[model samples]
Target: MVVDVVKRCFRVFKKANESTGKILGNMIKVQELRRLWGICHMDWVTGLPPGSDKSYNACLVIVDRFSKTQIFFPCCKDDTAMDTAPLIWNRVVSWTGIFTNLISERDPTFN
Candidate 1:
């Protein structure tokens, strides 16, 4: 009885909230015609067992969004932005040059 009443009240409250909600605008999609070089996506893989090098337990993976080519850089778990930036510059950027767009999952390190 009480549980049923509470559920009914909750449903009414939810419906009221939904009715008052604002509609969001449609999202814009990227078109390939606007594609340019140096647009890439990056991600980090961590928590792997230490390798033969012992220090490098994580990998920084960068992918060219247009070409679908990937580059992997071995890095230590404690690598700072200062430490990792040069690796990207020397190993990845040296070949592809500076990137205009870099997409990645929200990560504190990238900030």
Candidate 2:
């Protein structure tokens, strides 16, 4: 019963997918990322209770794409892009050195 339902739904979806491709014509291809030390990814972990001594409720996580190494910096929830950029530059980059590319989740404030 489930298999039959799935096949029916898949047929409908496949027809729509084919028609959309015909209407859209060409599709875009994204360049693949190479395993290179030049690439790095960053993200924020938020919505946590304050820590022991300081009132840190969030963390800025930076990961090296090649090395798979991570550096986590504890931060307050109120830190803005201005504060983060400098902190990453002065502290994180100073230690880990610089990278060619930085991939982020495009967080509203992080932009």
Candidate 3:
């Protein structure tokens, strides 16, 4: 019957697709978490025109890896390490004290 032929063809197609879909490579190794506030990740988000504060066009987001606590700091688009250093000092370092590791994506602002 036509239905039987269609089902057979569909099974063959599915088997072929499944074989082609598998990845033949090693997987990425994940880093081990050691302690609270040990690793802090930082990143900047931009593209907002400006807020009511007028001075800030972006935000700096910091996350503690172990605790998963986050802090958001309002920042200008042009702010560099010189500007962000004090903000990190006042907002994060003051509260968490010194941490062992800091992780961030390659961003010019963090440099």
lDDT of each: 0.79, 0.80, 0.84
Between candidates 2 and 3, the one scoring higher on TM-score is: 3
Tell me, by lDDT, which candidate is best.
Answer: 3
Top candidate when judged by TM-score against the true structure: 3
Per-residue lDDT for 1-111 in model 3, tens only?
A: 999999999999998878656576875453678887778888889987898968889989999889899989889889888998899888889888887877777688765
TM-score result, candidate 2: 0.66
Candidate 1 lDDT by residue in tens digits, 1-111: 999999999999998878555886786454452344457888889998898978889999998878788888888777777887889888887878778877776667756
- Candidates in order, TM-scores: namely 0.66, 0.66, 0.68
Backbone collision count in every prediction? 0, 0, 0
Clashing pairs in 3: none
For candidate 2, lDDT tens digit of each residue in 39-91?
A: 78888899988999778999988887777888899998788999889988997
Candidate 2 lDDT: 0.80
Worst 10 residues of 1 by lDDT: 28-37
Q: If candidate 2 were superposed on the true structure by all CA atoms, what would the RMSD be?
A: 7.0
